[model samples]
Every structure is written in C-alpha cells, then in structure tokens.
Target: MSWKLQSVYMGMTDVATHNVLLLLKSVMRQCANIELNEGGNLLQHSLWVAYQAQAAGCESPLVVAALFHDIGHCLCAGDPELPDYYRDREHAALAATWLSRWFPASVCAPVAMHIDAKRYLATVDPAYRMQLGRGSKQSLENQGGLMTEHELSAFSSHRQHEQALLVRVFDDAPYVGECLPPYTRYERIVRSVMR
Candidate 1:
C-alpha cells in the first residue's frame, strides 16, 4: 500500500489515513539505509524521539511530531540537485507542509518549528549549543546561527512553542545511546494519530 503525495492530494481521503501511515512506514524503512551524524539512521532517531516524548507524557500530536520531525532529512536527501545547506534549512518546513494536510496544527506546527526550536534553545541556554551533535552544529549555522532576542521572542509566542522545545529536547537526546521500544513499535502509535 505505497502512497504518493499526488494521489493523496487528489481527494483520496477515504484511504488517505491508511496511505499516509503506510508512507510513514515506508520512509522509516528507507531511513535505515541513510546514516545520521549521531551514529544511527533516521529511523532510529525518529523512534528514539517518539519514545522520549511518550515517556515525558507528551500528547499524541507531540509524539507524532517527534517521530516525523526529521523525516524531511530523508525527503530532502533524495533530491540530488539541491545543495546541502538548502536541504538542511528546508527539511523541517517541507515535512511540516506535507504533514499539515493530514495532521492538525498541533502536530505540524512543532515539526515546522523544531529547527527554530534548536536555534531558540541555543539562544536561551548557553550550554545547549555545545550539546548539539556535529551535524546539528553545522545545521545550526546553516539555520542562521542562534536566534536573536527579537526572533526568540517572536518564536516563543507560537502556541506550540513549548511542545516544539520538548520535541527539540528529545531530538537532541537520542544521540546518547540506543534506548526504548524498537522502531516498528511506533507504527501503531503513529497510525493512531493520522487523521
């Protein structure tokens, strides 16, 4: 049951939920082959984040956001024509845009803002910048360095700001060690959140 975005956008609501879930599974499987800088693949990273969110008592939307936050990395990496910096900066927004059609703003907004949340954390917490992995540090630079005070203030006003920060925290912690339920364990949880 592979799904394409074109078919999804063509009023295929009847199967959209199932198809979207299938697409997520497909992407997670694809992530196994793509190495992340944190010493694991995107699938592991996503699962780690999802598990951390659930452990923290985050709501379903936030957990879903955590799982899919880095999916943009897989999506953007597929385009050979795009530069690395473009891929780094655009992945979050790309994931968010695609997700918005199927998910509520609660889910999509954090996915969209997670990158900014990274930048925001760097601004507010001096120790946070040093905690970023090598790739994340590079992407942080590519993402306009740390957010300025004004930018941070504006970002804080978003309704999902706290959830975005929590997702960011989970995103940062996965590099420490392999932990929690396996990747497949999240399939049911993710599917439950699909509209």
Candidate 2:
C-alpha cells in the first residue's frame, strides 16, 4: 500500500487541519498530470526542494515556501508549449499570491522573488548559468533574459531578497531521484506557520 493524505486525515478533526488536508490533496491531484522536461512531476520536484531546504537549515517558513514555491504551476495550465513569456514568472506570482492566504510574508515573499533570485545568480555569478539544464535556460529567457546591473542592485535591496535567493538556491540543486520524505512529515511545520 502507498501513503495517502486521506489516510492521514481520518483521525483529524480540526478545521484548519481539514483545510490544509484539502489543499494538499488538490495540489497532489493537480501536479499528478504535469510532467517536467527533466523528469518527475511538479509534486516530486516540490518535495525535493523542501527536502533540500530543510537539509540546508533554512527556517521553517522558507522550507514551507520551498515545498510549494512552484505551486502556481500546478494551479494554472502550466503548459510549456505556451510561449516564451509564459515560462515561470506567472507561476511564481500566482504561487506567492495564493500562498499569502495562509502563509506570512516570510513565505509568500520568497516564492514571489525566487525567479528574480535565479536571474540575479545567473547574471552575477557568470559560471552559474552553466549549472542550469537546457529547460531552465529556456525558462530563464522567458523570465526576461537575466537581470541588468540595476535590476540586480534593486533586487538586492528587497527585504526578502536573501530568503528568495535561498529558495532558488535549493530549488536549483540537482534532483536525486527519490520520493522524498512524506508530506505528513511536514504537517507540523506547515500548521505552526499558518496565519
């Protein structure tokens, strides 16, 4: 038998817990059909990012943000074939806005600026671009083809710049081809930070 969110919900009766459960289920369902070009689906990549965040000693909210940072992709059509401009900013923006319903700025802010962080790294650290896969490079173009010097300076001043950069750093790490810790493992972290 496989682990399931519904199975974990049987004994839970709190309204907030119920809501989170529903959200998790919806995310799982939505991500099931969306496949990434590199391999794996959105949910797996999400879990991996969260796992990396935790391992990197990121604060709880940042870890949660990592888990769902790309959730906007799941929330929308997420079609890679759409056009150059539709690559990821829309998804990042959507995720930040959607996550704001339950999470604080600590969470939403990072999700919102993660793309900018990527652009910052790619432009500021010349060798950084080499680490990205073909898919990420194409997506970066859709995200405005790297940041200008002024954009990087402005982005650095944003209150959550470091947090977003941390999220992006973990997100950019190579996937290890594993299932990741189960969602239930992070429920406490999620509930503790909910608004």
For every candidate, C-alpha RMSD to the true structure in Å: 5.6, 7.1
lDDT of 2 by residue, 53-92 (tens): 9988989999999988888887776565755467465889
Model 1 over residues 106-149: C-alpha lDDT tens digits? 89999999999999999888898887778888999998898888
Model 2 TM-score, all chains together = 0.85
Q: Which candidate is the best by TM-score?
A: 1
Lowest-lDDT window of 10 residues in candidate 2? 1-10
Which residue pairs come into collision in candidate 1? none
The reply for model 1, stretches above 4 Å from the true place, is 1-14, 176-179
Q: What is the lDDT of residue 189 in candidate 2?
A: 89
